[model samples]
Target: MGTADTFIKNRLDERKASGIYRMLKPENSLVDFCSNDYLGFARSAMLKNNIVAEMAHYPDSLNGSTGSRLLSGNLKYAEELEQQIAIFHEAEAGLLFNSGYDANVGLFSSLPQKGHAIICDELIHASIIDGARLSHANRYTFRHNDLESLEGKLKQAKGNCYVVIESVYSMDGDTPPILGILQLTERYNANLIVDEAHAVGLYPAGLISELGLQNRIFARIVTFGKALGCHGAVVLGSNLLREYLINFARSFVYTTAASFHQLASVKMAYELLKEVDDEANVLRNYIFLFKQKLNNNSQYKLLPSDSAIQCIVVNSNGNAKHVSGQLQAAGLDVRAILSPTVATGTERIRICMHSFNTLEQVKLLTSTLNTITHAQ
Candidate 1:
């Protein structure tokens, strides 16, 4: 085999040895417990039918976007929907990207110009971390959700500083004190940017919009694939930032645009979100019920979070995977998030609650978890 083949084989072997080898499994009919579809819109046949019907408005024989949006791919209907989205989210303007990762890459890589500084949380998403690395700006990380640490970093930052954080942290499922952070950003003279990927459908629009801080933020990244149960994301901000990103964000500028059907899916998803706003409460209630079942079981630590993403800290790659396997055997779909996706000692079984999940499912899941953790 070639040298490249040997190198790839060695890397794969290392992952296996460390008990962190990743593989894709076919979709199963297991009970719902590990998906980010907090609103269950992905399973709504009604939403699919509506989206299909909406596609009739576009020109016939269209299988894909002809080119990038800057080229032949920009559909008038799609741009109209972008405006609709911005209005719904209470932002002055919005720009769609092919995916959440693409949006993060485009926004961060392009926004922070040379001589500017980016202060980010230590526990921010991997995509955001990669985005920061791509920027020309100096970057500093404060302790996750620690206001004092962030304040110190803010004070030390140079020129046109930006504070980047997620409205709801992904892995841990905790949220920062956003109002306090906003105050510090104002005091330190830094612009605030939030990734509300996990907070959007749960909150009326997102945390910024929920708090009526739409005018206070520099930018916000909202995704459709999670609670919205569709694909793509948008950067919500002022008209100027939208225009600037369109001109300079290479991820959006150079890549082929998302197909007409995909954009329609995003539009339809938000429309559905508006109709089923009460599902957010259902999901939160399930989260509460699941935690209540745990009831201070000293088996393993359950992370403190009011959101749908609940994590049981198992603290080792092998153990986490084993617990996840046991839950899967019991027809539950709980997933193990191992390190180096997270910190070394924070390997965990990630339980994602959904609006469709019944109270019985939550009880069974927590009971099974209690048993497995006891066996450990």
Candidate 2:
């Protein structure tokens, strides 16, 4: 075999030995407990119909965005949709990116410069970490959700400090004390950037808008894939920030824009979110039900989270996989998140609660989890 092929095989073997090798599995007909469709919009027939209707307003012949926005891809509909979304979120302006990863990588990689500092929560998403690594800014990580640690990092920051965090942490499913962090960042005159991917539809517009902090934030990244059940993301801020990213963010400037249908999906999703705000409440109640059911059972260590994403620590990759397998065998779709997706000893089963999930389903899931965990 070639040298490069042999090296790849060796690496794959190493990953297999560590119990952290990865593989893609097809979707199953198991009970729904492993998706990010918090409001069930992804599976909603109504939502699909709305998207189809909205797409009718655009050119029927258009199959794709011909090029990047700066090229032939720029369309009036796209710009108008951005404005509508920004208005809903109470932001002065917004710029769309092809995906949440693109939005994060573009924003972080371009916004901060040399002699500047980029500080993030230790538990920030991988995309943000990658973006920060690509930038020239000096980078530091505060302890997860620790304002004091964040303050210390800010104090040592040299120039143009930017603090990054997720409104809802993706893995642990917990949230930081955003108000406290905002106040601290204000004190240090640092720009606060929030990625509200997991919190968008679960909280009206997002947690920032729900708290009336839209005017105070320097930038907010809202994704459509999770709660909104759509396919792109937008970075909302002042017009100047939008313009800067339009010109400087390589991810936005270099890639082909999302197609007309994709953009229509985003637009229709937002409209559906407005009409079905009660879905969030139903999802939250399910979250409570699951927690209450498992509360008295001490077999599994449930992570503290008020968000749609719920997690239970299994401590080791093997144990997590085994527990997830047990749940799956019972026709539950719960999956194990092994390291290095999370830390080595912090492998877990990440459960996602959705509005469409029934009370009986929640009960069965909790009971099944308890049984499986007790056996472990």
Relative to the true structure, how large is the alpha-carbon lDDT of every model? 0.88, 0.91
- Write the residue-wise lDDT of candidate 1 on 329-356 in tens digits: 9999989999999999898988889989
In model 1, pairs of residues that clash are none
Off by over 4 Å in 2: 374-376
Tens-digit per-residue lDDT, 1-376, candidate 2: 9999999999999999987889888888999899998898899999999988877766563899899999999989899999999999999999999999999999999999999999999999999999999999999999999988999999999999999999999999998999999999999999999999998877968999989988999999999998888899999999999999999999999999999999999998998889765888898889888888885556568899999999999888888989899988988899999999999878899999999988888998988887775334
TM-score of each model, in listed order: 0.97, 0.98
- Number of clashing residue pairs in every model? 0, 0
Q: Give the C-alpha miss distance for residue 14 in model 1, angstroms.
A: 0.8
